[model samples]
Target: MRGSTNRNTRRVRGVLGAAIVVCAVTTALPGAASADPAGVARTAGAEVGTGVGVERVSVAPDGTQSDGGSTGGAITTDGRRIVFSSSATNIAPGNAAGSERVYLRDEPSGQLKSVGSYPIASPVISGDGEYAAYWVLLFRDTKVKLAQWTAGSSIGLNCDALNCSQPSLSGDGRYVANVATIGRPSTSQRIDVWDWHANTKQELAWFDHTAPSRPSISGDGRFVAYQNGRTKDVFLWDRDHGSTSGPIEGAAKEATLVQISEDGSKLVYLSGTDTYVHDVSTGTAHLVPNVKGLAIDPTGNHLLYAPNDTAGPSLKLRDLTAGTDEIVSNQPASAGVDAVSAGGRDVVFQSTADDIVPGDTNGKSDVFVRRFS
Candidate 1:
């Protein structure tokens, strides 16, 4: 559903902008045209759930230390590196009291490095694994800015004076989409997409009294999926013509989380207690064989959701092709699964499962990685 322009909390900001440059190699995913169906399954292997596991990568600390607490984070398509926000001291800009700064973690190296020491959130990586983007709140300002994280630099884009949030980057890192709110509390909220390479911005469509927010873009940078109003109505933004498509099928006004496939041909949303998948090309909505969370794999082949019949929201994976479903974890009490990154034989998610890790369960959530055996 669209987000309201009304401020849920008072406006507070700390830092403005800081740019850092470094060096790193750029990696790209294989093109969809060359993707092999059977090869993909074989690569994922038969033991899809055995070696699969989750890691509590981030947490909130007792004091205001760098890397102190976890705010939010996202993983690369290849599942190699993770980018998140933290208040840890080793980072920079120190602790801004209640504000958060961006941090990057190299899974292979187990190194947690501070990327940006600004109040940044909603970090998303591109499909090519070459770039990252996030929404940064300019200290003491109501206007939110979009920053790009590449090779080793954080550059701010020209978003004019509009207030924006929830930034989503495309696989190629050429396009970025975000929710832009115009006017005030009673103002209008619409989806604004920018072509970074072209240096152009366009407003797709308006949500009437509802504000379109939390946009997720496809790998090809052709489609954008976002929620509208309280009725989990997910709409697809067509970048070619600057228009929106459908509310999808089986989607109720109560649908909460929404995600789109990498190809931009499928839409997934949470309807009531179940997760529904819709074929955007045919406008058909079906219950994904046996999965329940609001998150969908990048390829759109698997979906993750919280099961209602279970005690805590367990991580359920649905195989779209086989029409089969399986629970990844046996944990009873779990929070909602936030995201799923699947592409290179590995699938990872951000969840809160107490049983997965011992003692460290302080109610705060962490990132988990699972490889399909």
Candidate 2:
């Protein structure tokens, strides 16, 4: 996910907000992957490793900054906490000017907690607001970092990644789905799930040609949707049943998988200029209603995206359930949706257009959140 990450989600409040900046994972077409649905034989379990301990640095950055850009990633259930990446020095504690870093905006406590270095991809927040998960280039390879807010401690995942792609966590931070390299000096990789509750990591599927996109996990950690690293086709894996379903025929090349629903009933994957929504309840894989669609709510009932053939990027939201589309903004520059709040009531995106918000005269890209009732 870190090869080159394009970020999405969360809006700016006071310009230089001390929010966590994360790169959004993107994908392209790949070839066939060798998968074994019956390969629970390769499952390896080990005690969860808690690597070196580091205390979080604190800073207070409100609406006053941005010598560089910042991209927002996750928001807590209550929306009081935010995490994003930024290059500006003032918003993050102990960060050098222009050095990229991740910060958490705790609006309730009025402080910013540093998550650490620039992540390989955007870090995700648990719905319970107790934890944050993301990966970084630690030394030889990328490593996952789990930040605990309640305990005020940050632990680097001592486990070697199945692959360095982004990791997805459950709302409670109980399960994490990631693709990791299976053996050394070979391109083979497998989808690995780290269970925090059981303190173990399991191999779901071992295959080759896996891409760098994040293997999205269901909110409850029951299902996982991922793109074939080689084929660029999407696939769904069911944990309880120990089965795999996909390479989702016709998924095309290039995509970002939204977090799967807890029930595995709603799924959305936004590809370049394509929005693919698989509605199990409707029995249809609806495609082609929006361009460069950004975020999909947890329930998959709403989708935020850009309009095709429009002068400016007209950010629009589609009510997937009702099949209605409404425009959110028409900023004259490029924009992208970052994170959607719980139940899809709110969204934050980054944009270079300065006229959308009052007094946004800085002429640089800024993050903004839009709410829906």
Largest TM-score belongs to which candidate? Answer: 2
lDDT of each: 0.54, 0.56
lDDT of 2 by residue, 119-199 (tens): 766667766667777777756676677766655455554445433556777778777776666454546666667775555
Model 2, position 49: C-alpha lDDT score: 11
Q: Model 1, 71-112: lDDT tens per residue? A: 555566666666666554433433456455665555544444
The list of candidate 2 runs beyond 4 A from truth reads: 1-62, 161-163, 182-186, 250-259, 270-273, 281-283, 332-338, 361-363
Worst 10 residues of 2 by lDDT: 47-56
Clash count (model 2, backbone only): 31
The stretch of ten residues in a row with the least summed lDDT in candidate 1 is 28-37
What RMSD value applies to candidate 2?
15.7
lDDT computed for candidate 2:
0.56
* Candidate 1 segments exceeding 4 Å error: 1-52, 59-67, 90-99, 118-121, 139-150, 208-212, 230-232, 241-243, 250-257, 289-292, 332-338, 343-355, 358-364
